[model samples]
Target: MKIVAVLPPVVELPEPSPGYLFNVERAYNLHEYFASKGHEFVTLSDAKESLEPHLADMSIFICSPFYPAYLTKELINRSPNLELAVTAGIGSDHFDLEACAARNITVAEVTGSNVVSVAEHTVMQILILLRNFIGGHQQAVNGEWNLPKIGAYAHDLEGKTVGIFGFGRIGQRVAARLHPFDVKLIYNDPYRRKDLEAQLGVKYVSFNKLVETSDIITIHSPLTDKTDTLFNRDVLDRTKQGSYIVNTARGRIMDTAALVDSLKSGHLAGYAGDVWYPQPAAADHPWRTMPKQAMTIHYSGMTLEAQHRIEIGTKAILDNFFEGKAQKQEDLIVEDGEIVSPSYKIK
Candidate 1:
C-alpha cells in the first residue's frame, strides 16, 4: 500500500541527548517505520495543492491539525483510491467529517494525545494573563523596571472566579489542575456530570452566568455549527470588565472581530490561545496585531511527548485500515454520513 504523509515544514532543532525518543534529523519517524514495513511512503509539506499529482496513486492520507490539508468534498471525490484519513493528533474537525462520511472515507484521530500538554498550557496562559506576566516580562527585557506600572494590572490567582467552557477531557483536567490554586472554578457544558463536578469542586453554571461572573474564561470546546463563534460581542459584553480569555480549542469558537473590539475598548484584560481559525493564519490576520494577546502558531498540542503518542496512535489506525479491520467505534468521528460521537448529536 502507498501512503502520503502531509505535514508542515520541517523544524530543525538542536541535536537531542542520548536516550531521547525524538531525533531531530529523522523527522516523521512513522514514515520511516511504514517504509520499512514494505509500504511506499511519500511525504509532502503542503498537500493542499501538491496532493493532486499523487491522489491517483496514494492509498492513505495522513495529516495534522496544526497544518491541515483540507479534504473538501471535491478532493475526496477525486481520490478514487483514498480509503482513510488520519489526524496525527486529536480533533478531526480539520477533515470535513460529513463529507468524509458521505464518501465512505473513515476518519480517525490520535485521541487524548495532547490533553495534558494543552491543559497545562491553558493553566500557564491563565496565570500569564491574570498576573500580567507578559507585560512585566517585556518591561524587564526593555531594561525598564517600573514597579507601579507593572503591578497595576497584576493580581493573585486566589479568590478570583475562573470559568471553563466545555467540560471535556481537557476542560476537566484544567479544572482539576486549578483546584490547588485556591481559585473558584466553574464550567458550562450541555450534559453535566454531577459526580465529576462535585469531585472537581466546579460548579455547573449556565453559559451566561459563566461568562458574566468569570474573572478568567478558558475555552476547551470543539468547533461545530452550534459552537462556531460561540463567544461573540454579546458574550463578551456579559463578561466582567477587564476579564481575560484563554482558548486552546478551535479558533473559530470566538469571533475574531469581537475579541479585538473588546481588547481595544478595555473590556477584556487580555486573550491568549494557540489555535487559529485558518491554520497557518494569513499574514495579516487580526490576531497577529491584537493587543494584549500571547498567541502562538497553534503548537500547544504539538509538544515532543504529544508527537510520540500521535505517531503511535496514527500508525495503529493505519494498521487496522490495511488489515480491513473496523475502526474502534469510540474513535470514529464520522463513518457513514452519521454523527457517532455523542457530543455531535442534536439534543
Candidate 2:
C-alpha cells in the first residue's frame, strides 16, 4: 500500500528539536514504521507542489492542522485509490469532508488529544487582552514608561461576565479553569448541558444575550456552515461595546474584516488568539496590524505536550487501520459516506 504524509517545513538543526515532530522529513518516522511491514510511504512538506503528483497512486494520506493539505473535491476525485485521510492532531476542517464521504474516504482525527493545551491557551489569551498586557509590554520594550496609558485599559477579570461559544471538551475545560477567577460564566450551544452547567456554575443563555452581556467572548466551536463567519458584522455589532473577544478555535468562525472593524470602532476593546483563516497567514493579513488586536500564529494546539499526545494518537490511528481494527467512534469525523460528529456539518 502506498501512503503519503504532508507537514510543514521545519528549520534544519543538528539535534532534533521539539519542533522536529512537525516536520514531514523528521516526524512520524514512517520509514521505520513501514520498513518491516514492506509498505511504500512518502512524506512531503509542500502540498501544492508535492501532493498532487502522488495522488493517483496514494492509498492513505496523513496531515496535521499546522500544515494542512486541503483535500478539495477536485483533489479527492483525482486520487482514485485514496481510502483514508488521518489528521495527526485534532481539527480536520482542512479536508473536504463532503467529498471524502462521497468517495468512500474515511476521515479521522485524534480526539481529545490537545483540548487541554488549547483550553489553557484560550484562558491565557483572555487574561492578556483583558489586562491590556500587550500595551504595557510594548511600552516597556520600547523604553517608554506610560503607566497611565497602560493602566487606562487594564482591568480585572473578576466581576465580569464571560461568554463561551461551543460547549465541547475544550469549552468545558476553559470554564473549569476560569471558575476560580470569580467571574460569571455563560455559554451558548446547540445542545444544553444542564448537568455541566450546574457543576461549573455556568448558565445557558441565548446567543444574542451572550453577545450583549459578555465582557469577554471566546469561541470554542467547530468550523461548519452554521458557524463559518458566524461573528460577521451583524454578530460583532451585537456584542457589548468595548467587549473583548478571543478565539482559540478556527479563525474562519469570525470574519476578519468584521473583527477589524469592531476593534477600530472601539466596539471591542481587544481581540487575541492563535487561530487564523489561512494556516500560514499572509504577511499582509489585516489582523497583523489591526489596532488593539492581539493575534498569534496557529500554535496553541501544537505545544510540546500536545505534540507528544498527538504523536501517540496518530500512531494509534495508523496502527488500527493497518491492523484492520475499527476507527475510534469519537475520532471518525467522516466515515461510511457521512459525517458522524455533530460539530461538523456538510457545509
Candidate 3:
C-alpha cells in the first residue's frame, strides 16, 4: 500500500540537533523503516498543498496536527483506496471524522503522545499571561524599564480560581501540575469523574459557571460541533473581567474576531496559547497583532520527547494496519463506518 505524508518542509539544520526527530525529511524515521519493507512512502510539503494530486492511489494518509492537511468529505472521497487517516501526533480533529466513518475509513492518532508536553505548555502560557511576562519581556527587549506598565497587569497565581473547560488527559495533567500553586481548581466536562474530583480536589461546574467564576480560564478541550466557537462573544462577555485565557486546544474553538474584540475592550485582560486556526496562520491574522497576546505557533505537542513517543505509537498503528492486526482500542477514532471514540461526540 502506498503511504503519503503531508508535513511541513524539512528544517535544514546546518548542524546536528537532537530535536529534529520529526522534521519532514526525518519523519520519525518512517521512510527508512517502511522502505526496508518494500512499501512506497512519500513526503509532501506544507498543509496548503493539495493532497488530491497524490491521493488517487494512497492507502494511508499521515499528517501532524501541528501542520494539517484537512481531509474534508470531498478530499476523503477522492481516494477510494484510502482506508486509514493517521495523525502523527495526538489530534485527529483535522479529519472530518463523520465523513471518514461514512466512507468506512479508519481515523486514529497517537493517543497520549504529547499530553504532558501540551499540558506543560498550557501551564507556562497561564503563568505568562497572569504574571504579565510578555509585557515585562517586551520592555526588557525594548531597552526600557517600565515597572508600572508591567506591574499593572502582573498577578499572582496563588489563590486564584482556574477553570479548565475540558477535563481530559491534558486538562487533568494541567490540574495536577497547578495544584501546588494553590489555585482553586474547577472544571466543566460532558463526563464527570468522581474519582478525578476527589483525587485532584476539583469541583465540577456548569459551562457558564466555569467562565463566570474562573480568574483564569485555560482551554484544553477538543474542537467539536458543540465546542466549535464555543467561546464566542457571549461567552467572552460572561468571563470574569480582567481574567486571562489560555487555549492549547484547536483555534476554531474560539471566535477569532471576538477574542480580539475582548482583548481590545479589556474584557479579557490577556489571551495566550500556541494553537491557531487555519494554521500557517495568514500573515495578517488579527491575533498576531492583538494587544496582550502571548501566542506562539501550534507546536506545543512537537517536543523532541513527544516526537519519540509519537514515533512509537505511529509505528505501532501502521504495523497493525499493514499486518491486518487490530489497532489499539484507545487510538481508534473511526472504524467500520462508525465513530468509535467518545471524545468526538457533538452533544
**lDDT scores for all predictions?**
0.83, 0.89, 0.90
Error of 2 at 115 (Å): 0.5
Candidate 1 lDDT tens digits, 1-347: 77887776655549744322322234347657786789888777777777888878777888888777788878887888887888778787777777777777777787788899999999999988878898899988999989899799899999999999999889999999999999999999987979897789899999999999999999998888889898988988989998999999999999999999999999999999999988879999999998988887888887878877876787778778777788877677767667687665533
lDDT of 2 by residue, 291-318 (tens): 9977889888888788888888888888
Descending-TM-score candidate ranking:
3, 2, 1
After superposition, which runs of candidate 1 have C-alpha atoms over 4 Å from their true positions?
Answer: 14-27
TM-scores, each model vs. reference: 0.94, 0.96, 0.97
Question: Which of the two candidates, 1 or 3, achieves a greater TM-score against the reference?
Answer: 3
User: Candidate 3: deviation at residue 274, Å?
Assistant: 0.9
The better-scoring model by TM-score among 2 and 3 is 3
Pick by lDDT: which candidate is best? 3
TM-score: model 3 vs. ground truth: 0.97
Question: Number of backbone collisions per candidate, in order?
Answer: 0, 0, 0
Better of 1 and 3 by lDDT: 3
Regions more than 4 Å wrong, model 3: 47-50
